[model samples]
Target: MEKQDVTANEENDLDDVANSSTGNLVDWDGADDLAKPMNWPNTRKAKNIVVICYLTFLTPLGSTMFAPAIADVMGTFHSWDPLLASFVVSVWVLGYFFGPLFLGPCSELYGRLPVYLICNVLFMAFNIACAVAPNLSALIVFRFLAGTFGGCPITIGAGTFGDLIKPENRGKIIAVWSLGPLMGPILGPIAGGYVGQSIGWRWICWILAIASGVGAVASFICQEETYPAVLLERKVRRLKKETGNENLRTALNVDRKASHVFGRSIIRPLRMLFLSPIVGSLSLYQGFVYGYLYLLFTTFPLVFQNRYHFNTGTIGLTYLGMGVGSLIGLGVGGVVSDRLLTKLSARSGEKKPEYRLPPLIPSCFFLPIGLFWYGWAAQANAHWIVPILGTVCIGIGVNMVMMCVATYLIDAHPSFEASATAASTATRSLIGALVPLAGRSMYEKLGLGWGNSLLGFMALAMCPLPWVFWKYGERIRTSPRFQMKL
Candidate 1:
């Protein structure tokens, strides 16, 4: 009898261990799981997007908000070097290049909310530091730090949308979110020109700091953790405590050490950048477009002030052409792209990422035409409206192309959208940062006509890229050679 009783107890213990060790994985309860970000209420998602868009806007705004003040900053510092003046503006964009490399991966590994909150606070602090800096070197350093922290939103904002919205409905939200990054730079000079001319360059930094503080507060109140892995992990922890299941685990590798996950996560964007042909090609094209955009930004005040004989304040107003063009692009691109995707998907009975490329075909033409028009018009001293009209075309082209590429990247990578975006951001930003430093020299040596012609020719040459991608993207994306192991 005693032996039989001991046997029964041992069997029961073995059964409990078996139950704990196997088939104990935790996941969303079902498709309707309200805890999942995708199933979150519309109000909740809208609030999060608002906070994200606000932060994204402020960061890029910080990148160039003081651009109109660059001359003043140089004068105040007793520095006449044009390169140094450009560097002060470009260095912030350089920070955009580096910050996304690590921050995007960190959000994937740890969670989005903590990273967002922490970066927001630090962003505000560094902006304040910029406002208080005593010297040019100190101000540059502070600005770079501010930019690095400010990059958190630009890096992770799309991922948040991916968390909440289905791919079919993503284009609209992305278009709305993109307005922040696209318009912020265009509007920056407009505001900075007036502020710098009236109040002095230092006030630009002060205003940015104040705006950043408000963004930080909004983030704390509205942002929530949207990363699926993080949410599942939290649910697993609750279940483990409630049911006393020691071996319960989330589908994501919750048991892995944070360091190990982070180490792998940090390398992902680089891997995607180098190994994935789709990402590499699109990023290179995007980088070229971005380079020219900044080239224009840096040289605009010089071009308008010298050729059009405009003052600092009016020089800033010239950007309004690009601003209006961007709005049109955003509206048309968002609506058309989504409708195209849906229409194409219905015809084929399946959605393809390449559907997003249709808009790029027309946009490619817009870029070169605008570049040539603006360049020659400005060189010939045509009506100011002519060059501004050219800027409108350039604006429409840039925004549409960027929007298409961004949406395609998100769709192609699916769960890896953040890492994919980080790769693209890193490349474009590196080019964006470096291109402007040479803008002054390029226009001086080649003159506006040939300098812009050079850019126009390049744009013309690359016009076939979108068509090529639309034809072959699926094959390239599926090719083992282009696959990222991570």
Candidate 2:
């Protein structure tokens, strides 16, 4: 009888411990639960990453693939204003600025897979519309819609990385993933130059449409829901149905109304953007870099064609210098980032996000130097290779900065990686869309030497930002004033 009583007491104690651990909420079955993305087999994670990376690469490729065809587009539409031509390329990026504001939040509420699938379908449909656009107005409208849908991968990609990969192991994966956004635009103009010069600009849209269609099909087959909250919520629903218990709830669903949750989800990214010091500062720097890249894209044709007397097909080749530099940056940055993070974490006995910023400090200097070199070299009508080499430096700096900052944001935010990335993406896309409008006028008034020198000066002023953040980032991130309540 005493043994039976003791067994009962022991069982009751075990039950109490379990309840306390879970707080009566549903969650992963265990640390090794296969349903958790982080616990999935390596092969499954790699497959998902490949699909996500391809979509990211394709969307940004669409953003600039038509850039080389801009003059032809204007000629076809019979529009003479240079500003209008610039607008034609930039309006698509403007869509990028707005899409993430809603999409990121929605993904948090629903699931990553659903958002990706819906956006893929819509993106494909809009690209087809762009291919069949009857006028410049129609084309611009179609482009904006396509861009908005195309931004799905950009907004949620880092968050997905956060879902599947541990912080220590993320740098290498992120470096590989980042090649999409950085290289897509670089390769776009090259492909566009030849495509536009040979077949016509309309084919560019058709090509994107076909690629998006294929991507949509592959995503449906491969992509799975990785968001923890959504997964737990699904499990809660299943359990409730099986046990006939109305009280079953996931932690995320506890005492929360649908409307309230939806409203908060929509506002979270904006809240983080304006209220968080780290997000704002890093985003500002990223915005400047992204804007500079687009500015170069808009002006490259004018420089290469008019100054160097290159044809359309040849003008596309100039982007190769930047592309080569980006490849170099990607390779070096990936290897160094993980090794540095590991070394620093080992030495400090803690993994902090600041470890990611060290490479960024020296990399930032390359931007101004490249700008100065390219500007002065072009202004003097030096060898075409001179300006091209300058772009290589710019590419290296840009890639390293982007890779580092993105990894930092993901590491710092923990569960809120998607919103943080959305905030960053929104800021950069806005700048990217607006800054190029001034490029033509700036280059026209100041000339290449002074114009690029001016940009270089601004870049030089911001070079110390990485050091400042590395020193104080943890304090700012932890402070109540900067923390997002969501």
Candidate 3:
């Protein structure tokens, strides 16, 4: 009887331990789960990235796919001034500047998927409103609103991938995703030009709405919630039910006394703008470059239409130079960035963001050289191909710089990836919005030759600035506001 009692106690002890282990497993209430995102199946993760990219592509298509219709709208609405008409072309970018201030932080509060769905619906509705707009004022307002809503994808898309992919492998995925936004301006004009001339300016809007509507449906079906905080909250809800523990909660769900109120969180970006030099410098540098690129885009039709006497259809073809150039640049930039990371990893005993700057050096030189070549060639009324080739060079340089800037920002500010990107987008949008307004007037005063040369000279001055930062970037990144060590 004594021996039997001892054996029973041993069995009971084993049962107790097992039950305790199971209980602990169910207590994910406050613990981090490695298996959450990091453990997601590779195939499922890849599919998610693809779906996100698709949703992202539709947003920009809404932004610029109406480019070819600018002239038609101006005439339809009886607007006489070209400057007034350019607003139709560039106002979307203005909205882009403002959209991120709200859309970005709100995504962090909710989740990427919810933010994406809501913004896209707004984008599509405004897009439809733009198509049927009866007057210039109404049209501009709708276009601006559409751009604000459309801002969600560009601001959040890169970070969404970061939430899913690790740093080591994210370079290639980012490279692929970057093409959609970069290529949209080029592709938009081609399709928009023909559609505007063939059908009506309104059809351009209709076409974008149809395409975006389809994308919206696909996004709703494919995109699951990706934010960790949001996902953790869901997990907490599930465990509360399973264990019947009313106290079960996640760190993300509970508001700490230390947490910022809604007002503070809302104004953080403005504070970040004034308080952070890194944000200011990067925004200025990237913004200027982006603005110059769009300035050239808005002015291209004028160059071809007036000098070469090309029809609108033919003028739109010039955008192909930009498309081809961007592809080449992105391809080269991706390869160079990855290789530099590997080399720096070996030298520093770890990867660092400084390595990403080497490819940028050559690209910087190309910017000025291409600008001068394009200006003088167009001025001399040289063969059309001369200007076309120069545009290609500009395209290559622009894409390289953009890709480098984007990757550097994301690498440096992993925790604030969304905000950093939002800052960048807002910067670019402001420049994009402002540049085209001055395009015609600038061209008239300086002529194509001098005006473009002036632009090229400006690009030359800023080209070397990136290298300065690359060398001493670590010191600058040490700022608490910027938090570069991430």
Candidate 4:
């Protein structure tokens, strides 16, 4: 009797311990589980969002801040060939082509935080290399290295948003997030012009390095781990520790081989781009938008200096028109997207990805309008303000459309949002790098009127994209492949 009682007591103790160990379980109890990022406190989510925004801001700021200093760099290096001078910026753009395809996949293998922070460190270090370079070749190599890592933030960022915010509540957050990239082209040159003119071109690189150092430190401290699978894996490890159960596992369990991780990262973006018509079409359109943006960065100086007779300092200020438009895009686009999502969700009795797309419609038509007006006004040498109006319209329309596609994609593929974003980014970055080469020649040969009109016609051809997706997206999404495999 005594032996049996002792065994019974042992069993009861084991049961109690098991009950107490529930907190450490690898799986979330339900959708309401606080461990899930979507259920994290508002304050906690805000911290992540703010840190991510700062990181995103650093990229575009670094890319274009050196623009006004380009001439000075060439003069200092005694570079007689204009193309070689342009190569400094072009090499950095080349990094944009490669970073997304690699880094985006790596984010899935490692957690978002680790991948982002590591890239930030490398990017900053390369900026220092750029600052102290002994020759033009050295500077070009460093700039390329910096850009290769610098693009990690924007590439991996859409996944972080999907991890934190539900589709219904994502619009305002996305708009705020987008402001960094849009405004960078505006603020960067403004600061770069004055600093480059007053101090020297080298200071532009030094200043960016310093700013990135601050960003890296802040990210290390404030940005929490956001990848859902990563969080679940952590829970699995913790549960194993607590329960002394070696078999504890989560759905995230997978091989961690560097080769396998890398191969998938390389191949997945290609698969998504080639296999999914939705991703391909949207990405191609986005490519045009991104390419156009870079073109503006390169071409604007020529336009303002030649047409408006603006000096460097004044030429930089011309970007402010687009800056204001960025703010408007954030405000107007966010409101319209959120309102549409809310209304559509209520009507359908379930929120669908299609809800994220209605706002894209307006932007589609408006872009060509801006392009044509901008072409004609700049062609006729109309008041500088007239061309500026076209810029504002372009800023708002392009960003609104961009915002819609990114958010819609997140909703469309929660499991592979990072990879999907990478695929889209690859197309866009490739165009951004290649198109600027043509932009100057195009404007010179065709003149602003016909050159921009050509771009406008291209924009018009792509306008059907939003409507097709808005109408048929559900059917496309329901295809066996995306729904099942992802």
Candidate 5:
């Protein structure tokens, strides 16, 4: 009888071990019986995404919504120089570069939800300070702080999505996810141009605050803890309650000395920056393109207002080309990237994350072509549509390039997705912040035609980077620094 009982207990123990391991590996699918996010009805998930999208929208809108109103701000504040005014737009990006170094690590330690909520509130408060600033210096200071706070969500949003969605379906889901960030810049200047021209620049800040507040409430209700370690901890707690097994803990989280160490939190993002060549090279290339794009962004109002004789609202409407082009590019690229991945996997006889680069090759050529057209047309004062058409191409090219880089980086380094993204953001934002200050000086000295031609030349030079990278990416990724085991 004793021998029979021992065998039965051993069998039950094996079953329990199997169940625990299986639970950990089961990819999160919102529709699955055990899927936490899927447990919410379809309507609920849609609502959550919409709310998160809206929240995401406010960050970029806050970044550039004030751009169209810069002339008014200069006159109102009695500032004489345009370059100084450009700083107002570019400074936000400066925050974008630095904020992630700290915020990315902090989110990993504290969990995504708490950090997300706290930072959104801080963003709202500081943005309001920008609206009510007593002087230009104060406004600049407030804007910087607001941007630093706003930076948290952009990083956290990526992690939050991973928590909610499974890897198998994430490609399509991420396409929808791209919409929010893309739409914000489009919607921002349109509304901002009208609002700032009619009401005041302060209203731009008020509008952002209101929109962000709504997003915060929605997140509080719908956004749950998605990190697996966090989720497992909750599961352990629940099991302890149900079966009174206090020892029921996840093996993945052993609470080692390194786990509790705070120093790694500060060092890890920087370490990844130096150690990951894939992260470094991709970040550098993307950063320059992003910076050039923003440099153009800061220059747009001046080009239209002074050169084309457009009013503020009309100047804002011109950005519609950029917005429309981005949407078209995103749709086309999303389809092509997925198809390319499927085909490459079949042909290579093994899946490689580097196969994703082929779809991005066209953008390298298109970007330079668009730059030349946009630069020369705007400089020559060709009919407005010609310049807008060029800008449309630029937008499309940028969207595709961004989508490819973002997807590749995430796919290549899944274990360190947040850190990889942070590295990219750091490089991109630093360039975005610095490029605009030179716009005024460059355009003024060279005249619009040659000044823009100079920009075109730079884009033309960069055209080969994506193609070379795409062909050699497999070899490059094989290096120890980029040796992603994915």
Candidate 6:
């Protein structure tokens, strides 16, 4: 009888362990589970995506929109050092570096919407602070705080993509979402340059604060909790309350001390960044690329003002090339990614995460071409349209590559998509924050031709990154950590 009890206890323990993993959780009602976001109506899902994309758009917009106004801010602050002026821009990104380390995991514990709305409110309030700041120091400090709040969407938005869309269809859906971030930064300069040129530098912050207030309203009124685990947990809570059965639970979570769970949740993004090779490799690759994009933001004004003799407002117009390229990339990457998956799945009778990579291959090559072309063309003082053409290519390439990398990470680790994206965002943010400090110096020393050529070489070196993952990604996914336990 003692032996029988031991065996039964072992079985119970096994059951508890199984329950701790995802498959055993209180899942959606099979195919018709209204609770499952995947089953949400196309219109409802569209609304959720639109809000999420708008949220995504706001952060980069806030970061880059001020680029055109950097000189004005510098003059107002009474500084001539470009790097010191850039500190205002770079410091905000520094917040991006840390927010994801914790916020991404927090989204997992809480739901995406609460975290998003709260962060958006904080971001908007800090923008108001920045507008009214008395000194350069105060402005820098407020920008960092605003960035901390604004950083939420970039990290969490990828997880939003994972939540609402399936792997196969995610490409096109993701492309649509990609438009916001890509367009926002380009658009920021276009508007900000004119605003800073005409009205004043401080209004840069005022305008963003007003626009963000609108976004915050849409967020609170329209968005819903999209995290599946969180939704299931809510269902479990409702069932427990309704039936008076305390034992009712979900497979997504085990009954553990809240403290223990919270501790793990807090450290998960860091752990993913440090320990997971999949997350780390892609983070490093994309980080460098993202950093270059920011560096370009700093350089565009100098390049146009010095090389082409364009005024500030018209210099902002040059960014339209990149904006248009991003839209094209969105369509191309989205349609191709979805179609490729559909066709490949049809052939193999199933879909695999590795299939997410083909769209990125073109990006690798296009980036270098744009780099080399823009560098030499601007150096030669070719027609103004020539360098703009090169920028268009870079825009399309970078957008497609980034969207694919994000989708690949999401597909590889669906359970930990938020943490995975956090890892990627963490590196990207850190690199972006640090690299622009050197952008002015690099352009000054190398001139437009060699400076961009150097960047092009970096892009060429990174070309192998997507290919390496595409070839061996399945093997990497086989590691114990990436797999969902049965």
TM-score for all predictions?
A: 0.94, 0.93, 0.89, 0.92, 0.87, 0.90
TM-score of 3: 0.89
Write the residue-wise lDDT of candidate 2 on 1-486 in tens digits: 435643554444334325646545666555765667897778889889999999999998998888888998989899989998888888888888889867876787687999999999999999999999999999999999999999898888888888899888999999988899899999999999999999999999999999999999999999989988787777667656655666766765532355765566557777887888788888989999999999999899999998999888788899999899899899989999999999999999999999999999998898899999999999999999999999999999899989999999989988677778888898999999999999999999999999999999999998988999899999988888766454
- Give residue 471's lDDT in candidate 4 (0 to 100): 93
Structure candidate 6, residue pairs in collision = 25-251
TM-score of 1: 0.94
lDDT tens string, model 6, 1-486? 435643554344334434545523455555555557876777778888888788778878888878887888888878888888777777888898888766776776677988989988988899999999998889999999898888887878888777778777788877777677678778888998899899987998999899889889989988989988788787667655655656656765643355654566556766777776778878888888788778887778888888899887888898888887788888788888889888988998988888889889767788888888888999999999999999888888878878888878888877667667777888888998999999888878998889999989988988887888888878877866655321
Q: Lowest-lDDT window of 10 residues in candidate 5?
A: 24-33
Per-residue lDDT for 1-486 in model 1, tens only? Answer: 435643554344334334543657766655766667897778878899999999998898888877777899988889999999998998898888889867876787789999999999999999888888889999999988898899999988888899899888989888888888789989999999999999988888889989999999999999999999888777667666766877777766643466765566567777887888788888988888888888898889889888878877777888889889889999999999899999999999999999998988887788899999999999999999999999999998888878899999999988578778988999999999999999999999999988999999998888988989899989988877666364
lDDT of 3 at 36: 51
Which scores greater on TM-score, model 2 or model 3?
2
lDDT for 326 (candidate 1): 87
- 120-154 in candidate 5: lDDT tens per residue? 78887887788898898898888888888787766
- What CA root-mean-square deviation does each model show from the true structure? 6.9, 5.4, 6.8, 5.8, 5.9, 7.3
lDDT over C-alpha atoms for residue 435 of model 4: 81
RMSD of 4: 5.8
Model 3 whole-model lDDT (C-alpha atoms): 0.74
In model 2, where do residues sit more than 4 Å from their true spots?
Answer: 1-23, 252-258, 484-486
**Candidate 5 at 230: error in angstroms?**
1.0
Better of 4 and 6 by TM-score: 4
Best by lDDT: 2
TM-score of 4: 0.92
Q: Clash pairs of candidate 2?
A: none
What order do you get sorting by lDDT, best first?
2, 1, 4, 6, 3, 5
